[model samples]
Target chain A: MLFVPGNNPGMLLNADVYGADALILDLEDAVAPAEKDAARVLVRNALSACGYQGCEIIVRINPLGSGYTGEDISAIVPLRPDMLMPTKVSDAGAIREVSRMMAEAERESGLAEGTVGLLPLIETAAGVERAYEIAAADPRVKAIFLGAEDLSSDLQAIRSKPGGEIAYARGRMVMAARAAGVDVYDTPFTDVNDEEGLRQDAELARALGFTGKAVISPRHVEAVNQAFTPGEGEIRYAREVMDAIEEGKRLGRGAVSLRGKMIDKPIVDRALRVLETARALGLGGAEHE
Target chain B: MSKLVEGIAEAVRRSGLKDGMTVSFHHHLRNGDYVLNMVLEEAARQGIRGLTVQASSLFDAHLPLIDHMKSGVVTGLETDYMSGGIGREISRGVLGQPVIFRSHGGRPEAIESGRVHIDVAFIAAPAADPLGNANGVAGPAACGSLGYAMSDAKCADTVVLVTDHIEEYPLIPASIGEEDVDIVARVDSIGDPGGIVSGTTRITRDPVGLAIARYAAQVIEASGLCREGFSFQTGAGGASLAVTQYLKPIMKRLGVTGSFGLGGITGYMVDMLEEGYFRSLLDVQCFDLRAVQSIRDNPRHFEVSATRYAGPHAKSAAVDSLDVVVLGATEIDTDFNVNVHTDSNGYIIGGSGGHSDTAAGAKLAMIVAPLYRARLPIVVDRVLTRSTPGKTVDVLVTQRGIAVNPLRGDLEEKLRAFGLPVVDIHELKERAERVTGKPETVRPGGRVVARVEYRDGSIIDEIRSTEE
Candidate 1:
């Protein structure tokens, strides 16, 4: 996932070219509150002007509590993005309210009732606490993401270097999303200059069970992609595992060994999954899909 | 003091039968490398024992050389890089002494310093005269620049030029001159041109890779280093080339020209030079066809011995003179340490190459990669192995966000000021761990398969045989 400022036409136009599975046109943190209206207009125009190819475009509108939320929804409903990202979602009530507003906006805009889905951003202390409830609130919610900066600020917690302070919240968001049977994504890492740090954080998020992450800069996406991709050694090992399993099955053996390493049906199954995921992401080889 | 012979067997005999002698070959052929096995087969026929094989780099096609290593005909080895077959064998501890690996620049230094004196240098050229004047750009086997063989020809006591095409007397525009040639022999085919171009070294079309390359190019441009007289180095990969291609427009638009470029010079570098992007090219090795022609025709395309490329003690290493270097990776840890040697399964498929030397030498070392490859994370809590120490790696660029090592705090501040997406490395690792599940530790057998040596010749990490 890569974030493009909703107000920046250049960024929004180039978002699909960055290989982000999902492009979040952010109207929340990326854009100043004063530019909220302008950002919505720019985002809506961008969606209407250019086809996003196959990229999942999600417009992250301001919180429902904000006055511009209704306007933002109304402006974007006509353009029809794949999903709407509602920021600072505190509870299930907020999601339900946003879904209804989106429905109303769609109706008024002459669009289909379920034209756009919802991806909630759990930012506040209350949001993290009610993550599971918020994720399960509306069927329209496809994923839930944790916003570390806002959560840290709301909790009055010290923002640790490298985000060690917010590790618990990030993990909780993953568990909540998984329990709710929806994908989870980590928040945008603010320091784009620290490429290694961004990579480390993304790796941590991947390990913590987030399906993907929200990236604030183009530089971060490659590391995020690499952190998620399998290495050549892993692919070779996976192939070996599959080969051994096939041989084992042919010999009526439940398990076998290759290069002295044990290979069972479960191991083969995991290997197949790795290959499948790699192919799905267009990352089976060194080249991008 | 006698003239060398023509056949591989004759060359081996003329070099004198001995239990141990160092023989060297170059990797100008890349995967098309065929000289090593041919020479080893002759040595085996003569019952040569304890032969120390020195190569510029080893590829999968050189796997047949392993039989000689196991048979005690070749008991030692030295090279700048080892990948695929040779890498697996070394990682399995099939050889007696640990293979000594050097950077592309360091290999020549070792030879010149008498640390690794070569007894004989067997060069495989595409075309050569009987007197040993040879060129790689004019034959069916044309692989490219003999940048790597230049050092061996100068430092080795004896030099043998093996070619598939023996041109007329005094082959004009010689890449390796007569002064370095002791003998020239004809072979069926010096190398397969098809194999030379097997790997893609063009710009990446993948959106994520392209974005990282662009951002890296941006960082280079923003650093105020993409101007006239700036020198740069790029790894031999598609994305690195993409970074170069991305920088071309920016450089052209700014009217910023460079004095020189460096690293594994390819056609892309040649094009840049011919187009007046750079005044000169410091080529340590030719990676493709165009570079060979450039080296032959363009006097400005100067060839430098490996010693001058990244030798720690060279007066001024080529890498040391680089403004920026874009590299690839298999895994990078949060501490900023990079692993290009071992894989997630703890098997080896990568080599040291110039990874550490460039990281430690270049003004800006940017590692470009996607966030995830094949479900397994490329950024780990701890890299399976460390080839380039994190201290030397300056910036990490990905499609998601950029992370600058804290050591470059000022640069980080500058990028942040530009409104770039800067994040801490630890945060990135945490996020990855959160999704992938923490990596479980794997116990290895007691035997050590490979030992990763830092540029300073210190052991940084060791890979043990996988426990079954």
Candidate 2:
């Protein structure tokens, strides 16, 4: 839900729309190679001047060793982005290097150290294999994103319906991030014109335990958000299940029955997770309000 | 005897045009028109203060009118539509008198009924003869139909045909006959016909415009209006032209040939006619040169007057026979009341030329606009100026969704059956607000600036001057 084409001031000014969780003032992949410097300068000035209307601001500096990464970091670190997403990370060493550079730039610019967080992009086959190490590389690393298009190309596999080609990489990334105690986001569905395709892709990501899917278009934001968040009926049922268990516990009963089924600990835990996920998206907490 | 005159100044003098008289002009030349500016300048040179200029429509090209307005040469204004510089000054209350707004149909009805008296009507003819026989289809400034000026010619005390090209004493197939004219003034150029139609009149490539057009076509198909001998009209705009594009495929699929295409005809409508999607084009105004060529060369393209197009007083008009018409709006309220007269901040930018008239006449009056324009939700709590009443407007189609008026429950269900995003008008308003946020209500200061008149000649809404 973070998107930017760094060279476009107009696109950069296209803030406060689509209700993105975070906006990545993208300098990599989205920008032309010749305009990298222009993109960096534009992103730096935009960060200094623009507002994203309460969305967390981030930047995807060009990949380390792409040669644009240092200039991108040097130009942007002083602007103090909320987070930085590095494109095409193949290993932990790259993440550590970016974190070090961010630290040095932060100190030089007189900003509080470690103010910016980092999210390494897991694109290539090596990147997926080293997801755990990359996630655990630096304290600033809070989440990692999969680059499905690149991963499928690297695997020499044809991407199919419901994302069969990237399933293994998705599972590995999720498990690696979980083990390393960092959040994981799925890759964006490239076919923006196909809303159904986007919805199915987002549903698959949600079922596989990703928090949210990366979106390439503003139109995709709503579908991705809906797929990630629990529906109203699900939220209500989760609340009802929790209330029954709470009442049973308060009455000193060992069992709780709902709709003629005896609910046990695992079921209760699942309901709790559902409610927690909804509440995390700022949905079910309003019941108390 | 030949009715030729010396210049605009001589025509004004020979017509005995006085200081306080109401001089009229037609906007058939559209943005390319030079007659309005030239005549006003001559009238100003004549020291004719307190003169009222009754034009069919005003464009940015008439910005020079602002100078005359300031110099006290022109003290009053009346028109079916106004835009650009003149509209800005009028909205700012530069003129002491309140402007009078009439629908395209209403203006002719007024002129015919003696409600609006024209002292001297200036006709910008592309081609004219010494005897004052003129037509829009003949010269370099050819604009196809002089439908708007026909009423002024028939009713004005004195009519002058101003042209750059004067032919032999006889001008064949005259749109305005010589008997109605008192004088003919030849000029260097009537206007640049190329500027008459811009690239905007073509189908839009914007995804939003395409989506709305698709939904609009679906609405037409769902309403069962895309059948054999269906009569239709659409504005010359991105979404409107795109609707024509989408409808062509639908019409082809259904094998239904529409009866006629009406309103300001564009090249797309001409294409529809030639492709057998439609039978004929009843062009009251032509939006492009292709339409001009079609009107002149093709027997199927017939030029009709504004009264014959949508006049409520007419026993039978073309709009009355219309099965559907696609329009655009600046604002639409939950009640389905429309405002095309002002912007988000309530500054005047447009006036209803045929909006109310067609809405009143057509069986299915569909309004297509983006849900929000530049973050200003077009669906408002209430329109700033109620240009077209809610009851007359049948359906509202936005890029995001479609809403039918409560009066049309059948259309609501029909749209839903088409698998279109059919929502309540209020829900559509809320959806737009969810994206654009609710804009602050724009209630301009208390001074009334213009009166929005319905086709039946009743004041529907009063546009107040914006002091802020």
Candidate 3:
């Protein structure tokens, strides 16, 4: 995902060309208080005008207490974004409040209930403690996002390049989202110029079992995607695992072994997921084998 | 006994430059050039009128020519390319006669064929001897190759060598020989060294540009032309130059050594030559100081004249041997005819420099540009000006998708088989339109302002005045 300032028409129009899986058009922190109304109108118009083909469009609205959230919800729900990322979400109550406003907007706009999903940003200490509840707040809650900057501030902790400060929050959010059967996204690396650092950070996020990572700059999108994508060696091994399982089934054997390693149910599921991702990304695989 | 003249005015007086005569100059100094303004200002002071100026290219530094045109000191214009400073005036129909725009190859061909005559050609020699032997090296404004001036020197009835640095009696390995120079003059400064060559050339960091570059490199690799002895050319635009960076790793993995790199030489091309990615570089102009240093020190980095570079009538040119070339377009129609001359709003901004020459000669001509720039679709229903005809252009690479010319169905099959994204040209246009809503077409209904001449000296299209 890439974050494009909602007020910038130039970046908003060209956001999909950067090859990001999703675009977060930000009307929260990116827009100044003076430009909130203007950005809201611009983003609402852009969502209606641009198809944003093949990419998920998520509008990051202001927090529920910001006074502008109600208007943001009312204006954007008509355009039917894939999701609305409510910022500064602390607990299940905040997610419910935003969902309530969204339901009202849906009724007014004649859109079916739950047409627009919610991705609550868990950026506070309370949010981290109640992440599971927030993820399972309502059926409208699809995923939870880690906003490390605000979470660190809430903890009164100093952020560092190594990101030891947010390690606990990161782990807790992933486990929480998994328990609730929803996807969790890692926070963006704030340093745009440090490609090596960004790659390492993204790899760390993937290792922590996060589904995807958000990028603040367009240039980081490719690096983050590459970090999340399974390599060719992994794809080849996955293909072999599936092949061994099929061969074992054809022979009526109760167990399957590939190159001296037993292929179990969990291993087979991981392999299937790898092959599915590789196929979706159009990567080369050992299909012939 | 010395052939050195006093100053520019003396050289102009000695060249017998009178009313209605054509004077020529080269643009090796680029935007830093002071010689064009110096010579034209002296001529204007001498009451010269109705003179036609034939130049290799005009930059913003020559904005003084607008005043000359207004005063009737200079009335006609012919050039390979015109930067927007003067191009804007021409677009407003500032001159009585329409400007004649020629390709870099076509300009020399026209001069050689006597189709366009020159009365006096003022050569901006960075270093010259009293006897008028000149070279671009060993001077304050060392702008590597003096290729464009060679044609004018040989064909002009009178040739004047203007220089800031005067060497010994005989300059060894002179780019402009003594026999071709009629008069030599000394100046305080010919051009700013800082402006003569860029400090360094870097690949674009723009994601869109990088994506297009990646796709173009993949196309070149899949074209089966990346084998031994491949030769190629690319423009100096950010996206076009980035193609070289992508091709570097591909060639390394494939163990392919290209024959030569052609056109304006940059530091990247120098690095490629140093690294053995290419055997040599055919330099017409140096785009940066690193290229200037390389051409001066490296024996394999050779300089070629404009006629030898891309002249259509030449027995053989470097462009003819090119395997692939990456170019840029302002807009391209479904038919693939490209427009680099005018912006989408019908304003004169750029002209064809080597766009047509390399496209006609290369095996695979690829255009690298974004699908839409600044809310305007680049793939349009029709190009505002046909700079390079679609028949010669083979591919268009954009961030959205790659479109191969329908004429090259075999190429489409190869690209698709390689798992590259290939879309029809019309579909590409529609894809662009979906993002940027259909723009109101800009039609210039005013009188003709400039005529675009192809490499063969045929009029391909005419740019009209934007003013009503």
Report interface Cα RMSD per prediction. Answer: 9.7, 8.1, 2.0
- Residues B29-95, candidate 2: write the lDDT tens digits: 9899999999888887887888999999999988999889899999889999998567778888888
Candidate 1 per-residue lDDT, tens place, B126-185, comes to 888878888777788776567778878888888888888877878877878888888776
DockQ of candidate 2 (2 decimals): 0.04
Question: Compared with the true structure, what per-residue lDDT tens digits does model 3 show for residues B286-355?
Answer: 9999999999999999999998888899999999999999999999999999998998768888888888
Off by more than 4 A, model 3: A107-112, A236-269, A286-288, B418-421, B430-437
Q: How many residue pairs clash in all the candidates, one count each? A: 94, 0, 0
| Candidate 2, superposed: residue stretches over 4 Å from native | A1-28, A31-289
lDDT, candidate 1, equals 0.79
lDDT of 1 by residue, A1-289 (tens): 8888888765665577666788888888778878888888888777876567768989888887778788888888778888999888898998999999999988988887888999998889999989999999988989998888888999899886578778889878888988999999888777867877888887888777788888877767777888877667777777777767767789999658888877666776768867776778665532322
Best by lDDT: 3
TM-score of candidate 3 against the unseen true structure: 0.93
Evaluate candidate 2 and give its CAPRI docking class based on DockQ: incorrect
The model with the greater TM-score, 2 or 3, is: 3
TM-score of 2: 0.69
TM-score of each candidate's B chain against the true B chain: 0.92, 0.98, 0.99
Deviation of model 2 at A246, angstroms: 55
Residue range A105-204, candidate 3, lDDT tens digits:
9999999999999999989999999999999999998889999999999999998878999999999999999999999999999999999999999999
- What TM-score would every model get versus the actual structure? 0.64, 0.69, 0.93
